[model samples]
Structures are given as C-alpha cells and as structure tokens.
Target: MKTIITSALVLGLSLSFSVSAVADDDAMMQAAGKELFNKCSACHSLDSSKNAFGPDLSGVVGRKAASLPRFAYSEALQKSDITWTEANLRKWIAGNDQFVPGTRMRHVEITDKAEQDYLIAYLKTL
Candidate 1:
C-alpha cells in the first residue's frame, strides 16, 4: 500500500512539473515576442485601420503579402504571390530581401528562428 502511494505521488509531481513547464514556456515566448516587436513598432501599428510607416499589423498572421487595401505596397511585394503562412512569415522575417527582392522596405529581418516563432505567435494575437 505504501509503495503504491509513493508511486502515485511521484506521478502527480511529474504531471504538475509538466504543466508548469508548458506555462513557463508560453510566458517566456510572449515576453520574447513583445521584446522583438519593439523593433517593428516604429514602422508598424498594432491597431486596426491604423498604419504608420508600414501597414497596420492587426491581422497579419494569415494575411497575404502586400494585401492591405489602404496601404500602398511596393511593386515587388504586390507582384509576388506569397501568402503569410507560418513558414512563409518565418522566412520573410529571417530574410526579407531574399524573400522579395526589390521591396521598398529593404531591411526587415528577424534572424533568430526562436525569436521569429515568438514574434509570429504574438502577431497571431493581433
């Protein structure tokens, strides 16, 4: 009976730890996303229908490239047939020039894959 109790306790503790770890990871990712977004804040706006130097990023996660009706996009981006999927967004952030050459916004790359993921996750919230 004591051995069974001990095993149950161990299992409970392990499950608790697993839950905690997942929560901690989520928190950390959010923090990283916020930090990374600062670099984009100068050009992009999070509010709907509000565009700064760049178009509003309020729903950018699943949005197609250069698809904001109010914002004038570069010819290169307008001509490109890129959709902002998770993989595409990751690639775009990591290397904008490579992703779309002749883009007016010449430099907008987030090289770190983890950081890119976090930023993408945060963008989905907008």
Candidate 2:
C-alpha cells in the first residue's frame, strides 16, 4: 500500500511539472514575437509620440488599418478596409503587401504561430 501511494504521488508531481513546462513554452513564444518585431523596427516605432519611416504604432493593436495621421500609407493599405485584430495582424505579418495587396511594407512573412501570437500580444500591450 505504501508503494502504491508513492507511485501516485510521483505521477501527480510529473503531471504538474508537465503543465509547468507547457506554460514555459507559451512564455517563450511570446518572447519570440518581440524578436520578430526587430525585423520591422527599421520602419516602425513602438512609441506613439515618435514617428519613424513608418507611422508610430503606439496604439496599433486596436487602431484602424490605415488611419495614422500625417504619415502617408500606401494606397493598398489605405483601402484594406480592415481593422488590426490579432488574426488580421497575423495575416499581415505573414506577408504584408501580399495580404493587403498595396501595403508599403515589404513582403516579410513570420510564419510561426507562436511568434505571431507573441508579437500580436506585445502589440496589444503597446
């Protein structure tokens, strides 16, 4: 009976550890998204008060697709008629101009879902 109890305890501990490992993986994925954003940094700025070659993206997560003031968006993005939701942002990052057909951003695709989610989640925090 003591042996059986020990085995059950071991199993429970292993399951708990497995769950913790999965949570770690999720956290790592979010970190990967921030890494992905580095590629876009040349043109984009995270700070709302500062403008880059691209528009400032301080509140872009929930902002309209092509509604930044002063900065000129390509005719393509201007007409996308879409909002910047996580799903849509994923699609955009996978291949920006291709997805929107007229966006000025060059075609760079971040195909990993974890990376995409991480980047989108970070954007929401901005």
TM-score of each: 0.86, 0.73
lDDT of 1 by residue, 19-78 (tens): 999989887887889889998888887766565888888778778899988898999999
- Top TM-score: which candidate number? 1
lDDT of 1 at 35: 86
Alpha carbon lDDT of each predicted model: 0.86, 0.81
Q: How accurate is candidate 2 locally (lDDT)?
A: 0.81
Candidate 2 C-alpha lDDT tens digits along 1-126:
999999999999999999999889767766776787798888888765676888877678878987977898888888889898878888988888679886777788888887788888667656
| Model 2 residue pairs with clashes | 76-102
Instruction: Please name the candidate that would achieve the greatest lDDT relative to the true structure.
Output: 1
Candidate 1: deviation at residue 121, Å? 2.3
